[model samples]
Target: MARTPADLLADALRRDAAAPLLTDYDDATGDRVELSGTTLANWVAKTANLLQDEFDVGPGSTVALALPVHWQTAAVLLAAWSCGAAVLDTATEDDGRLAEADVVLAAQDRLAPLEEQEPAELLGLSLHPLGMGMAGYAGPARDFALEVRAHGDFFAPYQPPDPADPGLLAGGVELALGDLVGTAQGLADRLGLRPGDRVLVDAGTAAEAGPVAWLLAPLAAGASLVLCRNPDPARLLQRAAAERVTATLGVQIEGIRELGRPA
Candidate 1:
């Protein structure tokens, strides 16, 4: 049976329900949170439902995500993909680009300036645990956590999009849906990825090597991905040793520089 990218993730969630799919660190609070496969799937489904019901974002629609490296951002990306919508990962809030998207997902701090332009509908996702000082904010924005909580755990899966259709568009280049899946599969095969394997991804965003190498590849191979904000040599080594991260994606280094191994 041919598998779509979303299907691959769903399958992994079913097989390894308790496996850690995402681990995010909060530097300010000094807290580490892990979202298991099942929990991640639940959040993705809820977020997808909210997008579908509220914004009418589905097949052929595009959603712009302008957020930092956080768990909510990852959930939104997966949710957009699950809805068969193409995702535009951009940092800057360009009016022209925002005008083209069906919806925009951004942090609460960035919503004010975006609202002034009236480019597109905005949804605020708060990375901070506390909800203080966000009382009067308005303008087509919905709370990420509250919206997800409102939807039921079950979400009707969207039909898989055409493999040749556009999945992501960076700059002026369109990345075919099949190309994304193929790249993910190729990396997984080359890295000997398998079920139950934990892979650490040291990249920044979905537009970078993060999604394809860390997110897509592991999901395609029925494994899990660990996302890190900063890839410090010592921290990475420690996490790899403690978490038993079997595979890593990023720059190649000669020997173990941090470990004092001879080059």
Candidate 2:
């Protein structure tokens, strides 16, 4: 048996060294990006190095992220986990709550309010290159792209924490390191999800079965996930058929209800 660590990112990197692990689609621009296991691991490592060297994010540190659903968000989340830092994922754009974080990673639009929070460090990921110029308007905000460019491509992986330590903490909810491994293993066994299987996730941030069902669960199973930005039944069905999705996670919304209907 392989060694189980507190960090899920490290476990994922070790298991699927060269497999394709993340698939992201941008509906606004119709842009699609795919990150193979190796490429994703490298990017996560580089980002982790930047966070550690520049912001001093490491074990026992807490970083808050208010990012949209995108490839960069996944990279940042994994990078934080790789460094053994707890992530605080917040959907609301409250500066007061963001201030409590040691470091804040947010989108450009959300940076202004957080400026007053006086966080230890702030990094903004622009949805597009045009937004980079706006970074100067916000005090102490740095461009995430520029920072990543300055760092070398290599990063020494941080030492893994004990299985009993906290690996992922969301708001007040804490998941033990061992529980995360068990959850991943359980998801794999229950879903019969494999490396090539495609999973469709139709819910957005509002749904109970949102990020965990769509992003984390699929990745944990070494499978690809197709995110449906909106709850359009027709579009959901079209994408499901197009992507040949094997499993789906969503509310009993219109789209999911349609899937359950017999032909």
Best-matching candidate per lDDT: 1
Q: In terms of TM-score, how similar is model 1 to the real structure?
A: 0.82
Per-residue lDDT over 58-101 for candidate 2, one digit per residue giving the tens place of the 0 to 100 score: 77778888886666777787787666677777777873767877
Residue range 1-263, candidate 1, lDDT tens digits: 44446776678767878878877654445656688888888878888888888888777889887777676777787788777788887767654686578888878888877777675577777765332224556657777766667787767745656666566765566665667788878877776776667666554643364455557777877777666665565566676767767655553323322111122
Q: TM-score for every candidate vs. truth?
A: 0.82, 0.78
lDDT of 1: 0.69
- Residue 231 lDDT (model 2): 48
lDDT of 2 at 54: 88
The lowest-lDDT stretch of 10 consecutive residues in candidate 2 is 252-261
Clashing pairs in 1: none
User: How far off is model 1, as Cα RMSD?
Assistant: 4.0
What is the C-alpha local distance difference test score of each model? 0.69, 0.64
